[model samples]
Target: MHAKRKTALAVGAMLAPVLALSLPASSASAHGYISNPPSRQAQCAAGTVSCGAITYEPQSVEGPKGLTSCSGGNSGFAELDDDSKGWAVTSVNRSQQFEWKLTARHSTSTWQYFVGGEKIAEFDDGGAQPGATVTHQVDFGNKTGQQKVLAVWNIADTANAFYACIDVNVG
Candidate 1:
C-alpha cells in the first residue's frame, strides 16, 4: 500500500505540471485601425511638383513602426500646392486632437512641412543616410477645418527620391 501511494503521488506531481502548461496564455490588446486611402507610387518631378500614384494607408495612433521607401528614379518628395503635382493632405481632424505617424526614405535628405502654403516644421534626422521612418504629432489648435501637411526632401547631395506613410490618427 505504501509503494502504491508513492507512485500515485509522483504521477499526480507530473500531471500537475502538464496541466499548468496546457492552460492558455494571455496577450495584450491590439490598437484600432485608421481609415485612409491606398498605397500609390510617386516620383519627384520639378522642384515644386511630384508625379506618381497617390494613396493613403490608415494607421494606428500608437502601435508598431511603419516603413516607406523611394528608390531608383522615383523620388518621394514633392512641393505642397493646389496643383495636381504636389504633396496632398487629408484632414484627419480639424481640432488637432489626434496624432499621426510619418515615415520617409531618402538618399541623404531632409523633409520640410508646410500648412496652408506656410512652413510649419522641418525634419532631417540630422543628415542620416539610407533613410528611416520618423514620427511626428501635429497640433492645429481648436480650429475646425482642413489642414494640409506637406513633406519635401531638401537634400541636394544626390538625387532625392522618397515616399511617406501616414499611419492612423490618435485622439
Candidate 2:
C-alpha cells in the first residue's frame, strides 16, 4: 500500500503542471482597469463599494469595441452601470492623469475618453504593446461639475476593448 501511495504521489506531481497549463486562465489574469481615480470596478475591487463578482475581478470588464456603458455591455458586471451605487468621485483639475493597471498587457490600438456621449480625448497607441501601467493626461476643456468619463482600451488584434468609467468632479 505504501508503494502504491508513492506511485500515486508521483503521478499527481507529474500531472500538476500539465493540468495547470491546460486550464483556462482566470479573469484575474485576463486584463486591466483604471486604478488611479478608481473607476467603478476598481472601487468594487478595493471594497470602496460592496459588489458582486466584480469585486474579485475588476479587470474583466471587457466587451466588443465602441461600447459606452460602464460595464462594457456585460451583463455580469451590470452593477457597474448603477449610477445610484454611490461611486466615489475624484476631484481633479481641468487636466487629470488617468492611470490603468494592466494584468495582461495586450497590444493596443487606441485609448479613448468620453464625456456626455462626446469623444473628449483619444490617444493612439499604434498597435504597440503597453507596459504594466499606462497613464493618459486628459484635458477636460470647459467641462466641469460632476461627470462620468468613459475610458476604453481597444485591443489591436482583437475586436474587443476593456472599459472603465471614472466619476469625477472637474475643478
Candidate 3:
C-alpha cells in the first residue's frame, strides 16, 4: 500500500503542470470591475451603493460579448441590470482614462466603449493577454450629460466578454 501511494504521488506531480496549463485563463479572470471611475458594480463593491450578491463578487459580472444586460444575465447580480438603481454617477470628461481592476488576466480580443448605443472607442489587443490591469482612454466626441458607458472586454480565446457599465455625467 505504501508503494502504491508513492506511485500515485509521482504520477499526480507530473500531471499538475499540464492540468494547470489547460485551464482557461479567464476562469479566475472572474473577479474584475471598473475601479478608477467606479462602475455600478464598482460602487457596490466599494460600499458606495448597496447591492445584493453583486456587492460580494463585483468582478464576476460577466456575460456574452454582444449582450446589453449589465447583469450579464446573472440573476444573482440582476441589480446591475436595473436602470433605476440610483447608482452614483461619476463625473468625467470627453477624454477619460477608464481603468479596470483585473483579478486575473486573459488573452484579449478588444475593448469596446459605447455611449448611448453608439460605439465611442474600441481598443484592439491583437490577441495578446493583458497584465494585472487594463486601461483605455476614450473620447466621447460631442456626447454629453448623463451617459452610460458600456465597456466590454472581449476574451480572445473565448466567445464571451466581461461587461462593465459605468454611469457618468460627462462634462
Q: Assess candidate 1 and give its lDDT.
A: 0.35
Q: Would you list the rank order by TM-score, best first?
A: 2, 3, 1
Clashing pairs in 2: none
Model 2 per-residue lDDT tens digits across residues 1-171: 999999999999999999999998764346999999899999999999999989998999999999999999999999999999999999999999999999998999999999999999999999999999999999999999999999999999988999999999999
Any residue pairs clashing in model 3, and if so which? 32-59
Q: Which segments of candidate 3 are over 4 A away from where they belong?
A: 1-29
Evaluation by TM-score, superior candidate among 1 and 2: 2
Error of 1 at 133 (Å): 2.6
Judged by TM-score relative to the true structure, which candidate is superior, 1 or 3? 3
Alpha-carbon TM-score of each model against the true structure = 0.35, 0.84, 0.82
TM-score, cand. 2 vs. native: 0.84
Off by over 4 Å in 2: 1-29
What tens-digit string does per-residue lDDT give for candidate 1 at 31-72? 112112211122121222234322221111121112122221
lDDT for each of the candidates?
0.35, 0.94, 0.86
